[model samples]
Target: MKWRVESSNMKQLAAVLVCLLAACLADKPQPCTSPPLLTGAFTVSTQNEELWQYAQFIYDALGQKIRMKDLGTYDNQSFTHDVLLLFREGVMYEINDLNRTCKKLPLKADFHPLAIPKDAVLLGQVVIGSSSGPGQGLLVNTWTGDIGGTYMMTVTEFGCIPVTTVQHTNKFGWIMTSFFNNIIGITDPSKLNPPDFCPDAMTEDVTREPADFWSLFFNK
Candidate 1:
């Protein structure tokens, strides 16, 4: 009887230790890098505004390029276009499919990685769904910081997949939220290439800052 009691107490102590260790691991910040090549869909919306857009995106971090095809209703008018940013070439191409025309502008923004910034403050961690069973819930971390503007981001804890991002800028009165979905590794490398018409794109000689990219879509 005495031996059994000691063994039971040891088991309980070991269980407690395991729980503490797990808690510590979860609390520790885990910074992760996104996959080099990916394709996804996202929705962007402005706060207190009817303006919204749904876009399919192809990202090639390794090649320093990204492309977005979007259709949106702004001010009750439907519009569609494709924007391609080539970091290496320092240029952006805005393509109008219906007119078969492309406008080329200088893009000075550097490539920003999808991972959480080192200076970002962790807001909290939460589960999206039920955490009671395996494969039931997605654990995610929320981070906030100023990157040109105030921004908050939520990403999956395990794979560091971006779930949503909210950005605000006081100077521009801009508040936008974006939600990501259907993200997967890029299957066709050719999808990252600019359209054939881009070679003959008309150059727009307007000076643009990096932040001007967002303003291009939100000009109401």
Candidate 2:
């Protein structure tokens, strides 16, 4: 009887230790850097029903470029495609693989589609970690324009890489939702290389006069 009681107490202590270890691991912060390759599915929900949206991304941090494929369904039809965007040496290029073309456009400072809009407000820090890993999270201000509701977004991270984002708005259903999975480091160097062909410059305003150009230059 004494031996059995001692063994039972030992088991309980072991279980307690395991729980503590897990709690500690869960609280650890993920890295702020992004993974090289991340593939994932997004979903849009309305009337309690959900539809799958597609997104696959490859990041070339060293080259400051990104390649992505985005697919979504509209009007009961589906569409799919890929696009490569390069930002190098104060220039931006939009590459079209199927047409074998590239478009050089003016580089708007700090312009990124996924970046938090300049008008949005920044909220306090947050933690969205789950069982799989820590999701050091960011809470920010947002809005549901169509429904005229209050919106909030939580950008979740995994070791510096943003792996998931959860958005919510009062009076608005699940309008947008996205998360990442199958993240892997990039191994192929070719994915970072720029296209060999030269791209044409974006069309300029035809109405601008020579004097206007001089004025712009002098102002800069």
Error of 1 at 210 (Å): 4.4
Q: Please give the CA lDDT of all the candidate structures.
A: 0.77, 0.48
Question: RMSD (Cα, Å) of candidate 2?
Answer: 12.4
Q: Report the lDDT of model 1 for residue 71.
A: 89
| lDDT of candidate 1 over 1-220, digit per residue (tens) | 9999999999999999999999999778666677777788888777646567888889888888888898887767888878888889888888776877778887767788777888889899899999999999999899989887888888888777888888876543455655566466877777566668776554765655655556555543
Tens-place lDDT per residue, model 2, 78-101, is 755454545565344545677777
Candidate 2 vs. true structure, TM-score: 0.44
Candidate 2, overall lDDT?
Answer: 0.48
Clashing pairs in 1: none
Task: Please list the residue runs of candidate 2 whose C-alpha ends up more than 4 Å from where it truly belongs after superposition.
Answer: 1-53, 74-81, 88-92, 107-161, 168-175, 198-200, 203-220
